[model samples]
Target: MRIELVKGVNLNIIPSKQFKTTRIFISFIKSIESKKELAERALLANYLEMCSQNYPTQIDIARKLSQMYGASFGSSVDRRGNYQLINFSIDYIESKYLVGNEDLLSGVIEFLKEIIFNPLKVGENKNFDEETFTRQKNNTIT
Candidate 1:
């Protein structure tokens, strides 16, 4: 998928016409929030990148991917101009690569759903995960 910057908005999707690939995609997002807000969001983002019920530990999750050959998955937090974008996405390699005969698309969807719906929350505030929040705050101070 080709990634091109846009003028405004939160998200965008682009497809590859030059490459004859099916069942594949790449996504882009642009976010605008105060650094303070992003700092808060970052912590929650960090914790959610951990163990979930379907896969209890980081190693467990990695093993699942190994079983599936290789499923590209992860999240990234960064700044783009005045925007701080946190893009969570997956790119399916159609029916040609190192994946199950029918598991690629489903796996991508499930991965996204996990992050979107189950991100760790701050104990009392509508902010970030506590451990990440505290750690980030401490790091910033130093």
Candidate 2:
């Protein structure tokens, strides 16, 4: 099922009972512009995946995931024809499978929202955290 949330934004759902996990994907697609822009997108994916204002470090993010029944969230960049896509995905075990029957779907969604929309900023400027920026830049380079 697919629904258009706005003019160009959409929400898609594909349900399956075969797997014990649920996956949510969000993507940003745009026409390929330049090599520099591609590099920036790659760096952005890395930075977004690693940290946020609420989860300040990789360790903090990992701990949160661990608490969420071993769920994992990540981001990546892909090229499709003339378009470049930056994708964010999260996969977690279904709440029904938990021993306590706890529902984690809402929590998972909130966590992703935090990572994507509440990134750690550097001071009052419109820049990503300096330490995280440098680290992700180096990681993307290698």
Model 2 Cα displacement at 73 (Å)? 1.4
Model 2's TM-score against the true structure:
0.89
lDDT of 2 by residue, 59-103 (tens): 999999999989988898999988899999999998789988898
lDDT of 1: 0.53
For each candidate in the order shown, give its overall lDDT on alpha carbons: 0.53, 0.87
> Can you give the TM-score per candidate against the true fold?
0.56, 0.89
Error of 1 at 37 (Å): 1.5
Clashing pairs in 2: none
Q: How close is candidate 1 to the true structure, as a TM-score?
A: 0.56
Clash number for candidate 1: 0
Query: Which residue runs of candidate 2 sit more than 4 Å off their true CA positions?
Result: 1-10
